[model samples]
Target: MTDDVRNIVLGVIAAGVSATLGWFTRSYLWRRRLRRKQAFFGLPENSECLLVVNRDPGTDGAVHRHDVFALLELSSIVKDCSAHVQILSHDVGRQGYGEHAEFCVGGPGSNRRTAAHLATLLPGVRINTDPEPGEDRAAFQLGSDRYRLETGVAEYVLLARLTGSQDSRPVFLFCGQRAIANQAATRYLARNHEKLARRHRTHSFVLLLKVVNSQAYGPDVVEVIGDVTRTAQTPPPAPDPETD
Candidate 1:
């Protein structure tokens, strides 16, 4: 080949290589920054967090499969945060939640730990259940807005991110009026973690998510009702150990 032609070919190849490397580097850094933003709890390197699942009291400690599926999704994001995660049932989680960050799944009816904590901390939100057997009615009341099970009406899940002055570890509550709503809340968090983290970087926040057509679309149709973080008043005093 002529010297001029050879020189042109080498220059083209070097430019292509350089472009590829630049693209790769930018992509890598962008993903790294995203992962950092998704680290909601901000646990230090190798620290542990708890995933508390619910078990049906009517059954022999059998967990709902949908809830486990949601946990798996959350686990992946938690893993990316450089934290060790341990899964536990609500019964066990009731013992302690002081040192480690906690992710409590399921609503008050299914997870008593979630119930106790919600009752103690979040006064504005209440989970109500039917006392009569064979009733399929459940509701989550946040302030004056009530999301109850009714024909053609929407249901909701309450997703709360909280931190206490006494305890540095944050507590995440994922509670739905129904099982589908519970799963939807988790999926929503996973899908929008970066946006959520940026919005709620340090302060605590509460989200009310509406699950449209939950009977049909399940978690796929979930949407945010509102960001009630500012309205979520300071957590009430911890219950007395003897009374609790």
Candidate 2:
């Protein structure tokens, strides 16, 4: 072949190699994250971890793409934490829609097992699947403390649950849009603080972090460790008397 043709062939080969190498690196990093998360949380095979990603209605495609990257980052964390993984999504009616990715370590009854594991990881934290009167599902509270956390299909809600409460915790909300994350955080605090206080009245604070696009929100977008406030109080009444 002529010199120019030979150089063109070499260039194409180099490009192909670079693309393959990039894909491999990404895959390796993702697996590492999954392992990290699993080990950090000590999630068993039956245990599952849920990640809620909030997105704007006008930019569903962008949100989805962003989550795909977030998932990879989360996967590395899960691997590091020694946990399993799954992916799900949620849409806030009239507001917007988002995605949810879950990591399951074990088999059937994983929810219960995962909850138990979480309790151990989150010391002094009261965990429950049921909601009290006017409470939301996917909610958990610190024992006798005002701190509460609620999870929806698309987002996670944190509340202080007391009078004059403010968001003091450095919480992170991973999403493609800042506005959507802020909105979700505001709604969660507005809707559930009172109810959370009734159940565990104490000094509590909630933080919201939104992950803007996967490229922007990297592996360190949401850290597992953070500060939280604790308080003592009586348990609130059940949401349904019949169920009790």
Candidate 3:
């Protein structure tokens, strides 16, 4: 081949090779991200997932506004992984935990499904649904530490990924002291799922999150209090004999 022709052909071949490598790299990265999300969420690609809803008490078929936002955020996540979202209200919801990936939202005060999860899965955690006068209602008691609610100033919520002993699917729990806190938890999950996946890939965990300035930020301002996985999952210590 002529010198100029050979040079042109070699340059074209190099460009083709570079393009092929770039496409492969992009494909690999996309697949990796998808896998990590699937693991974090316990929902395989193109699977049927359940969204257990918690309706507000004393309301006739009405969902809290913040809870609705929370569900919408979670729905985007489910959509990202190509999973179908089938919603069931806490009143009539009946299904096995491990059969499909599930996301349960709202606190026990309104969500009996969440109450059941705390009862069966998280034995150490206790939520005060009702309190007499001069006491803080909707407080959380995990072991000895008590998280009190203060309206818009401060609120606490729980986000947990729980898997049954014999089941591989994980059920995500979003229990909050208030409706806004529940939305905050879901926002945190949506933003930090990749980081969470890296640390606890497919493993169960529980987190305590604080919502700050909800009156101003509307679930946008949040901070992590700590990981309550160990304390929440473990049963509380028996009453001390000395105290008794």
lDDT of each: 0.76, 0.36, 0.90
Tens digits of per-residue lDDT, candidate 1, 1-244, equal: 9999999999999999999999999999987775565456756668888899897555688877778788887788677777899888787775655578888998888888888877766766656666454334676665556667653347788888887654477788888776667788888888887788778775678998888976667678877889876555544346678853
Q: Model 3, 132-186: lDDT tens per residue?
A: 5345689899988999998898999999999986456888999999889999999
List runs of model 3 lying over 4 Å from the truth.
131-134, 240-244
**lDDT (10s digit) by residue, model 2, range 1-244:** 9999999999999999999999999999988655543332334444545543433334532443433444455456445444555454332112211121232121011123233323322234453444243343333354433323322213332222222223221112221122322333333333343443444433333333332232443322332122343321333345675653
TM-score of 1: 0.80
Where is model 3 poorest over a 10-residue stretch in terms of lDDT? 128-137
Best by lDDT: 3
Clashes of each: 0, 48, 0
Candidate 2 C-alpha error for residue 238, in Å: 20
How does candidate 3 score on lDDT? 0.90
Clashing pairs in 3: none
Q: Pick the candidate with the highest TM-score.
A: 3
Q: How far is 236's C-alpha from truth in model 2 (Å)?
A: 16
